[model samples]
Target: MIRTSLASAPLRVLAADATPVFREGLRAVIDRTVGLEWAGGTDHADAIRRGVRTIGPRVVVLDSAVDPTCTLIRDLVEINPELMVAVLFRDHDRSPASVRVAQSSGARCLLSRDTEASVMVRALLQAHQTGRYVDPRLTMVLSRPWQSASACDAGVLLTARQRQILALVAQGMSEPDIARHLDLGAATVSSHMKETRRRLGARDRAHAVALAYHVGVLPLRPALVAQRGISPVRPAHTD
Candidate 1:
């Protein structure tokens, strides 16, 4: 059953699709919805991260075909763990492999590339508020899942501390704040972040977030729209 919650605040949303037409079309649908702030849209993963951090949107919708790699999801979650990611897959070829990849990267909702605007809006609102959404069809497939964890592993073994750091980073915690929370020196935290990036082959902080999500190291949350004229929610203050 899909659980519903009354949002105490508004949800800010950022969307990215490789194509302008798709982005615009989705934008129009989302724009008409109440209690949502369209925080702008982009095509690049790096740009998406920047927008999320700066805008602090609670939900992000992405195109799976354009940004199919796990890195796309991982990076978003790594930088904004609280942000929910919704993905649209092409209806013609909604393969299980693609669905699993999307889920592994923390996509809360997966819809057919051809999903109707109303359905998309409903899914978006659900994901934004609760961090979980499932297409009935996709849920049936996931129900059969029994793969060994090793089979799903990507070989990016992380230390326990590294995992904690990645999760916090995904939650949008600043490096200094993470250091303070971890009770470690800022320089040491910096070193860890640098090393983590190097190991993930990440190009930058945003890239690191993408790479982490790509590898299933982080997961997307629910999508929530902010009320009209209200500011979006930021990650909880770590100070």
Candidate 2:
């Protein structure tokens, strides 16, 4: 039997894919899986909404290529925050913009269509429990240095102290806590934070952490990749 830590009933899963053959194949996989129940599959956004309302699935697997912006994913989460959304994207669609859209829209996980069935199931299960999952491949992609010719070029680098401070911040440490841990005064910590933000062009601590991860400064946390991109579309606000 498939060993699972899931409580109570099997996890209910719904899939939305524009291609009929692909949708049926995914449904078949879910049906054969031990701890998953194939709620239903749909090719249209309207039908997906109806299926969620009728089937009351705990997880929805969405095709990012079909719904690039993940508007439906956002709508579903808005309706039920407890519902986990796992997005499947084509290899070509795996751009920084796509990642940002998936993150900002509150998608629990992002996967490639070629992802193995077992891995996909694991991602779904992890997303249900932790509310987030970043594919290791995506982590590799995000951790690479940027090649874009933007204001913040690939040559931009963080000092050793800045990297250390960012790593602590990524671990959810407060400025004061980081000061105590590093044997530095609050003022010194605050000054370092300010300079970090300026150098990374981050709007706040969370953005700084995201930038650090994107630039391969801070290690990637498989459970939680910052939803926002290095330079998010919207103005960054304090989290």
Candidate 3:
């Protein structure tokens, strides 16, 4: 069972953002927070991994602009499943695809870069305590009902192998990397990707992932919804 209580000590927080200014700014806010500790910040994924090993923070706030596919987020969580990941996305960068990728990769929270300090703090606390926190803004996107039955039907056309490839794609894996990981040929991986896109009628890989979430091929965890204190929005009726 997952532990629900906050640690007795201040929750140690680390940040990874490519921008030096933004990284330090987050570090300052974390340090100033009452029950949080600023473990450190880094400007790259490698450094972030090194920092994680060195500081052992309970939560890591990642700038999605730096790692848009959330591959780093997935890698970090794989290293330590208990480590809460809070992804920060720039305003224009927010989309169903990015949100789905972060969620699928085990991110505990998603917040905007310009989110209020108070809200960030709450997100941090909630994520650490409850194991999930989706931004209220993105909840609507996640809850949107399929516009047509064909969209839902499209989901069933994907083979299990196709689904596996798409899941990795959502996590931001390159075709070659995915090929290597799955022990398949790179050309075969490409073929599956193409077929998956065709089956979903997705314009691109990202669109495919967004559609996956929409059609229930990639499900949003119940804890994500329960912790947010909101019900899933009902689908609009099409007469």
Best by TM-score: 3
> Each candidate's lDDT (Cα)?
0.67, 0.73, 0.74
Residue 196 Cα positional deviation in candidate 3, in Å, after optimal superposition: 12
lDDT of 2 by residue, 127-237 (tens): 888878889887665454432322143224666777788789888899999999999999998998998876655557875675555545565565543442222333224
TM-score for candidate 3, please give it: 0.62
Better of 2 and 3 by lDDT: 3
Better of 1 and 2 by lDDT: 2
**Poorest 10 consecutive residues by lDDT, candidate 1:** 224-233
lDDT of 2 at 51: 79
Q: How much is 175 displaced in model 1, in angstroms?
A: 42
Candidate 3 residue lDDT tens string, 1-239:
12223458888898888789887778777767778888888778988888777779899998876676566776788678899999987765565545655777678898878888778888889988888898887776555443234334434457889989998987889999999999999999999999887655565787677556545565545764464322222333555
lDDT of 1 by residue, 1-239 (tens): 12224356546778888789989987787667666657889888889878878888888888765565555776778777777888877653244445665686678887776787777777878776666787777666545432223125523345567768877897889999999999999998888888876555454566566545544555444331121111221222323
Error of 3 at 98 (Å): 1.2
lDDT of 1 at 91: 56
TM-score-sorted candidate list, best first = 3, 2, 1
Clashes of each: 25, 0, 0
List where candidate 1 sits over 4 angstroms from the true fold: 1-8, 140-239
* TM-score result, candidate 1: 0.56
Provide TM-scores for the models: 0.56, 0.61, 0.62
